[model samples]
Target: MNILCVCGNGIGTSVLLKVNVESVAADLGVDVNVTTSDAGSAKGTANMNDLVLTSAELAPELEGT
Candidate 1:
């Protein structure tokens, strides 16, 4: 599975989410390829990933992406 963790700048928040996602997927014994991306970049890359995770503040912008 490919999972994307997105944030405003693609640095801090996204990176943190990526780590947490990886940890939980590990605990669940699910193999996943997780990555971090910014809101703008995510818009273009979202389709390439299986899942896109982000904060509520950014959710609307990413909807249907």
Candidate 2:
């Protein structure tokens, strides 16, 4: 699975989430690709991704997906 963790700055909170997700994947013995991206970059990017993880305020932007 491909997971994208997003935040305003795409540094602190996103990085923390990425670490936790990685630990969970390790315990489950699953192979996944995790990435961190800024909300702006994520919005502008044209590439396809499996999922978007973000705060409640940001959720609405990704609702249709």
Q: What TM-scores do the predictions have?
A: 0.95, 0.83
Q: Candidate 1: how many backbone clashes?
A: 0
- Minimum summed lDDT over a 10-residue window in model 1 is located at 56-65
Candidate 1 residue-wise lDDT at 20: 95
lDDT for 4 in candidate 2 is 88
* Model 2 lDDT tens row, 1-65: 89888887889888999999899999999898999987777775414677778889876665655
User: Cα miss at 29, model 1 (Å)?
Assistant: 0.6
Give the lowest summed-lDDT range of ten residues in model 2. Answer: 42-51
Q: Which stretches of candidate 1 lie over 4 Å from their true place?
A: none
Tens digits of per-residue lDDT for model 1, 1-65: 99999999999999999999999999999999999999999999998999999999999989888
lDDT winner among the candidates? 1
The global C-alpha lDDT for each of the candidates, from Candidate 1 onward, is: 0.95, 0.80
